[model samples]
Target: MTIQNRERFLNNVAQHLGRERKTKNVERPSSSLMPQWQVFQHHSQDELADELELQCHSIHTTCKRTNAENLHTVLQETIEELKGQRIIASDDSRNETFGISSLYEDLQKKGITCHIWNSADGQYNLDYAESADVGITFSDITLAESGTVTLFNNSGNGRAISLLPRSYIAIIPKSTLVPRMTQAAKHIHEAEQEGHGVASCVSFITGPSNSADIEMNLIVGVHGPVEVTYILVENR
Candidate 1:
């Protein structure tokens, strides 16, 4: 929208909600003038998990669920299936917080060249994430309704790590799974309130990158990963 139109709209909304319109460029909290109806409710853990996998599979993406203890094994198997020589991985603290800190070491032991993404701190030695065959990262939240995984961009989390690779692997903890996008957004906002700070770049990725031409010919990985895998850690 045009700046003038947006400002006028915002002022109207603010006045209707008994709020003062902002005169600066700062973001203002949106008010709910009209009462919100009960539109969505939380789903059971089992339901969310099932729905997430179903949605992912429908789009040709693979979602694997395994016990937390067997995560290392499942991760290794996924890499083996890809048979890629070079892999780029995230060094996000969530890896250790979820109890799988040796992922990088494991990759190195397997003779696969591994690069840790540290773009936030200017450690861009690995350059663009597109050069790697597979990119690995952790998910802070997963929305079951659309089978989407949320990636927070920071020093350790790079957007390209998930989008530029031929294949993307995400380690998702079950506790972070939500029934829909609204709940996922609430969780991210709450986390930010507790000091996670809003992610500068929050991505909701569903399956891999795909596009169809006017001729109806489908092309995968034209702009992003051809294959996306979600390894759900059930015990978490």
Candidate 2:
């Protein structure tokens, strides 16, 4: 939308609400009582990983820990256990750092079809992801308290790569593990303050998709992947 049009729309809304149009950004208010900042704040990385696993169990998602040396084996075993035939992975460079690039080549040699996300391909990415047995991507930040993995979306990391697949796998670096959403938000905010570029869209996925409707009927896999797994690896 054009700036003029947006301003006019805001003015109209302000008129209806009996308030002046806000022309300048305001500083966010601060609270003295921030219990969120204290929860698990002092936990070590190992402790955070343990709490992450505990939360994963409650959410019905599998969490595994492996070092860089054994990540390839653990990933391969997980895919074999899932019986994945067609896999879709994000075009993320971290996959290479974690040895997943070579692993994909090996999987293809073993007759498992694999596709890495290509933004240029456009709609084909979506079509393939819809039929993919599994989707794999690296987590930007992981919340230990809720078993959540944060994905910052971009052209290379499309939303469909995580949302459309039958199953999803998040490769979590130990350094990315945080106490909760509060820490995650702080990291992003700090990045912004440091003039770092951040993705416009961020996804916080806790577990397999499930919903409880008005009548409290629980349904799983309604809007996204039926199964989700987290593979935690020590990055350093």
Candidate 3:
């Protein structure tokens, strides 16, 4: 942001608060009780994965386990189960690392259309996502406590890849698994401190879109994907 815009934003905030904008930065208070740092801190990776699976049931999401070697086969099977015809996937390097690059070719051989997100395509990306039967992405971070997947969206992996498709699939590596959002935030903050920066859009998706009406009738797939499947890849 420009200096003038930054000052304008602060002025607007100060006016709303009925106080003048302070020139100096204020030091934050620290608490002695830090439970967030302790919850599930001792749990092993395997234990975290188990917790993720257990929470998935409550969130109305399907959880699948696989290894790096079988990821391609398992993913293909999952696409078939979802009856996906036209697929849209993020152009994430981790996909190639986990043996997914060849699967796209195999899918094409079977006449399944797979469109990888391309920045050069511009509007065509959104157009493809709208008609896509399934959208696939690799989770940057997996929260076991809430069965949530964190997507650090970028030019190559746009938010539409996850929000516009009928069905969604997230491939999570074992190393990205964390106890919850606490650890995820910490990782991002530390990365920024180390000059690694962060994605402009970080999406935390738990499960398929759902809502309840005034009558308390629960509706699924109201605003997003009708179904979501999380594939946890071990030893990735």
lDDT of 1 by residue, 1-236 (tens): 54568877888999999989867799767876622322224467777788888888777789898987888888888988987678888878767766666866777887888887765546363464667889988887888778888888776777878988889998888887877777777787888889967778899888888888748988777788888899988765
The Cα RMSD in angstroms, rounded to one decimal, for candidate 2 relative to the true structure is 3.1
> Order the candidates by lDDT, highest first — what do you get?
3, 2, 1
| Selected candidate, larger lDDT, 1 vs 3 | 3
Q: Write the per-residue lDDT of candidate 2 for residues 208-230, one digit (tens) a residue.
A: 99989858987879899998889
Say which prediction, candidate 1 or candidate 2, comes out ahead on lDDT. Answer: 2
User: Which candidate has the top score in lDDT?
Assistant: 3
Model 1 per-residue lDDT at 30: 86
Per-residue lDDT, model 1, residue 223, is 82
Candidate 2 regions exceeding 4 Å error are: 1-30
Question: Which lDDT values do the candidates have, in the order given?
Answer: 0.79, 0.92, 0.93
Q: Give lDDT: candidate 2, residue 72.
A: 93
Q: Kindly indicate the candidate among 1 and 2 with the higher TM-score.
A: 2
TM-score of each: 0.79, 0.88, 0.89
Candidate 1, superposed: residue stretches over 4 Å from native: 1-42, 120-128, 192-196
- In angstroms, the error of model 1 at 50 is 0.7
